[model samples]
Target: MKFSLFITGSPTSTKACHSALDFALALMRGGDHSLAGVFFYEDATYIANQFAMPPRDECHIGQEWADFATQYEIPLYVCIAAAIRRGIVNDSEAKRYELDTSNLAKPYQLEGLGTLISLSSESDRIVRFR
Candidate 1:
């Protein structure tokens, strides 16, 4: 199954992010389904943060997703509007533009919602982890 994981919550103190992450992992491990990639949108798009670090004891779900995405080689995309609105830009983006580079995690590209639309067109199942 060509699936796209759409996350719609902030990375910090956001239930949608956590649930989306969990759901993506489950789909990755599912015996009968195939996952294509993960897409972040709205406030949940903030989950694409690479520099997100909390207390040591606390679970770093964002990093977990980074590692998972790297391991699986799945494409993780963030909405450009959302990322900008939330102030999460990467080095490249920061250079091209001026913004914080905390949210553009590796394996995740900052793109427009049109990308998601294309993904939805190609995806067999578009699951919303909100």
Candidate 2:
């Protein structure tokens, strides 16, 4: 089995991101399937930016996502259109979009809808986390 993920809510606003990470990690443990892709759109795009850090006593949701993706080598991606509009862009994309370079550390890719569609075609099922 294969799964495609779509997260629409911000990580800090909901536990959807953490729950999805747990699900994906469990899937990896089974080793019977692959993560086709992870798509974050709408306000969820903020999860890809490291700057979403909350003050002390708050959970580091974005860091949790980055760590999970890095450890599992999952291709965590955010909607390019959504990210750009929300002021999140990499050095390369920033230049392309004529915007300032933003803080997108690693393990996250700013990709287009085509990536999601491709995953949809390749995966056995499309599972939306939130």
Candidate 3:
């Protein structure tokens, strides 16, 4: 089976986000199961913020998500509108907005709601973390 993912919770504030990551890892490890992509929406867009810096004692959840996506070669998509609202801009968006810097990093790309819909349509299952 193939699966698509949607996260609607803050990485640090909710255990559901971590559970989702663990579930994704398990699904990918299981035979013949593939992941289509992970879409971060609402407060979950913070998971794609490249500039986030957690204290040494705390888990850097954003980096953890990025690393997981990189290791698994999974596409990580952050809702563009939500990202902008949260100040998580990419290089192009920063240029477009004439901002001094951008906080979006690799493995997580800005995408519209259409991407989520497309992934959901293409996958056998849609897992949501909220």
Q: Kindly list the per-residue Cα lDDT of model 3 for residues 1-130, writing each as its tens digit.
A: 8999999999878976788888988987886899999999999998888777889898877777788999989999999999999999999999999999998978799999999999999999998999
Clash count, predicted structure 2: 0
> How many backbone overlaps does candidate 3 show?
0
Which candidate ranks first by lDDT, i.e. highest? 3
TM-score of each: 0.86, 0.88, 0.95
Pairs that collide, model 1: 8-44, 9-43, 9-44
Instruction: Summing lDDT over every window of 10 consecutive residues in candidate 1, give the lowest-scoring window.
Output: 96-105
Q: Write the per-residue lDDT of candidate 2 for residues 1-97, one digit (tens) a residue.
A: 8898888877777778878878888888888998877898888888888677688897677787788788878888899999888888888887887
Q: lDDT tens digits, residues 1-130, model 1?
A: 7788788866775677678777777877886777777788887766766666789998777777878888878888888888877777877778777554445767778888898898889989888866
RMSD of 2: 1.8
